[model samples]
Target: MNITINRNSETPIYLQIAGTIKNMIEKNELVKGYKLPGERQLASELGVHRNTVVKAYGELVSEGLLTASRQAPKGYFVQSAVNSWNFNNRFFPLEKMIRYHYNEREKRFQEIFNDSVDKGYISFGGIVMDKKVNPAGDMGSIVKHMLQFDEDGEIMSFYHDDSERLKKNICHILAAENMYVNAKNVQIVAETNQALYYLMTLYLSEGDSVIVEEPIVPDNASIFRNGGLNMVTVPMEADGMDMDKLEMQIKKHKPKFIYTMPNFHNPTGAVMSLSKRERLLEIAQRYGVPIIEEDSQRDFRYTQERLPSLYSLDQYKSVVYVDSFTLTFPYGVKVGYVVGPYDLVDMLGRLITMTETFVSNMGAYMISEYIERGFFAEHTKRLAAYYSQKLDLLCSQLDQIEQKGITYQKPQGGILLWCTLDENINERKLFLAAKEKGVLMMPGFLFYPYGYQGRGHIRLCFSNVSDQEIVDGVRLLGEAIDQVKTKENCDE
Candidate 1:
């Protein structure tokens, strides 16, 4: 996004703009079909007339360097086709041409960011739970026990539907939360992300509208978008999503569903009040719109009193509850489940048959055994104690630093702490300086679906690091903040 212009240059401003953009395209800085900045934005950024930037874009169009796709708002897309008018060259199978494109872009970005990850860095950027409390040895013991006891034929055959043992165990555990559900409503999936994607496929079509709470999980946002759904966002407040605004938007858009996380909202760590949860369910029932409640973090409470989930509060059966073990268990296990009305669950089961037949049965077996023996409860109890201390230590260290303008809430439950700084502070600048100091944090915008609207917010996860690491990381984060602010003053 960095574009520089020399106002005193003898060359025309429009040509300079065109030349710079063309060079970026030629250098592969802008990938194929990359959306170019709007003309007004580019012009205002460079302190030039709008028409000059428009003329630059026109120049590119004349040279066949850019092409407009049917997707509007992104006026010009950088094209690989030079003579796009050529019949044979332009004709492409719709399915195959776009195949693997988004994945490639994702891989490209992954590589770009992986360079910042260092062996010694104190990283608070990721949501993955710490492996120290991961119960690997306990899980291994359970798997060995399963191998000794489970009949080989049962292991080989996909005999029973949807891991009945695991579902039964899940139901038993969830009864404490008042989520009384039979096994028929549960279907195991590989992961929560996959579950959300499948549900998106079942519920949404191209250009269908979906109501989302602003600053949601980015992967969820991406899944909704890739499924060809238009996102309408409602503001999220400290208590929960703004209900009045949600009702207004729901009436306006009549979205396929109201997607939300009522407990420990990602990157925010705010819990929805009981009254608000009831109100949300009432609104959904009134609108006849199903709610997709990602309740993964409901079990991760550290200190705060647990709130009843949207699913538990819903008397109308309008909430589609999704959760996964990845946040609490090992990543490779990748096991999750979805619970809803019988018809919806049955449809989801059939959809899984069409795509991924079943999740790792061996992993599911281990989880089931772990839960059956009461080890899962033990593990979570220990995790809650471990993370509660870590969260307190992190917040305490930040407070001790006397770092002015940094404000955060010590979360009642969940892995992350959302810190908001004064509007004068730049999260991006702070991120770079923190990275340089071997401390990594997730920039706030990664939680949002729209543009870079998360300026002063940053998310720091406490579940993945040791106590010493948290202390050191928070101290270094304060240093990085001071460093960023000092640099900002110098620049001014």
Candidate 2:
């Protein structure tokens, strides 16, 4: 009932009224079944014509935000109480405070994951590093060494002014992968998540189009949507994104840039083949489109023949490389970097400074120390060996139930297994049954831009779970699939 009307605004009075009320209903300020003031009463209160209030009420009613009673004392009632507000359009003209928001699907998934964890579910849901392989002791030793040797307190205090040492170390790290770059081209961020988010917000405005893989990492999809970028998603094939579809989308949408995880892609774990890498780079450069290569999983290769990163193969300087130590090291080591053109990196640094002030100097120092002592190379080798075994076990166990309509390709590297259920299997029911069986995984639809055409897929992350847990978790998943099949049979 407390609606404010800005008389001077260009938006119509009726629209402003309707938008405000809709916001209230979505925010749950006006809970379900709350009665709205009658048109005449509200019109009088706001000093508007009764028809103006009627127009406002009509809009909300049409949108299903409110319901109109046909009774004599006709009043509008709130239809639903939404805890999470989902705005289909870019921004609310009335509410200038909410410039951007989180993806509602990602928000719900976080809730479900948290709830499952609280119930002690065996988690195949997160791409987290396994504790068995965590280099906490080694990292701790470095931390102690730095503390003991520090004369200026730079490591212990917030006295660092730049990311020079970390950038130089990252250059060396990339050099080992044959992707050479100078410190001037590197801009550090808290993590790859931040790197993507900052890049999208910095370079693109709201409603600008960008092309991405269909079943992208939910977190990255969330970032794109929340930034108001019109995501043109191309489906993933066994090798990589469907190149023909990618080209079509590129020409149609004319995206600001292309974002790819050409290494071991998240969720799918499909590495871009050598041919695809060259082709993608060629297509990107031909279109004068800059590609953001997110190589977070580049270091986790197991059985796959390593292909040169798109950044390394690019002769056109059309690729911006983004990577993180979070996946390679402990999650607490939130160090990530962007290697791009000098001006872009400089601008990214300025944006980081203006917004977050600075990246974690301690994390930077820790990574630099690890690289300097030659520990990083050894650690990655150890991870590859350890995780390869886990991946093998997961694939073998999955092979046991392959006849049951659960299908997947064995990824040569990376943390996750992208699975396709039989077309008839109810994905929602399967997810619930899995949770009921004390196992959790990500439904594939959550990874899609608008949950389009992903009902038959799910992603199981193997890097975090123990070998025994992986076995048990797969058993539970198989059982869940059986339950769904049984239920479907019963329904028939």
Tens digits of per-residue lDDT for model 2, 370-441: 888888888899999988888899999999988777898888888788888875566667888998888888
Error of 1 at 294 (Å): 0.7
Highest-TM-score candidate: 2
Residue 2 lDDT in candidate 1: 64
Give the candidate number with the greatest lDDT: 2
- TM-score attained by model 1: 0.75
lDDT of 1 by residue, 173-274 (tens): 889878899999998898888887778777666766789887776666767677767787877889999998787666656577788988888868888888
TM-score of 2: 0.76
lDDT of 2 at 230: 84
Q: What's the lDDT for residue 339 in model 1?
A: 92
Question: Which segments of model 2 are wrong by more than 4 Å?
Answer: 1-98, 112-119, 136-138, 148-162, 486-492
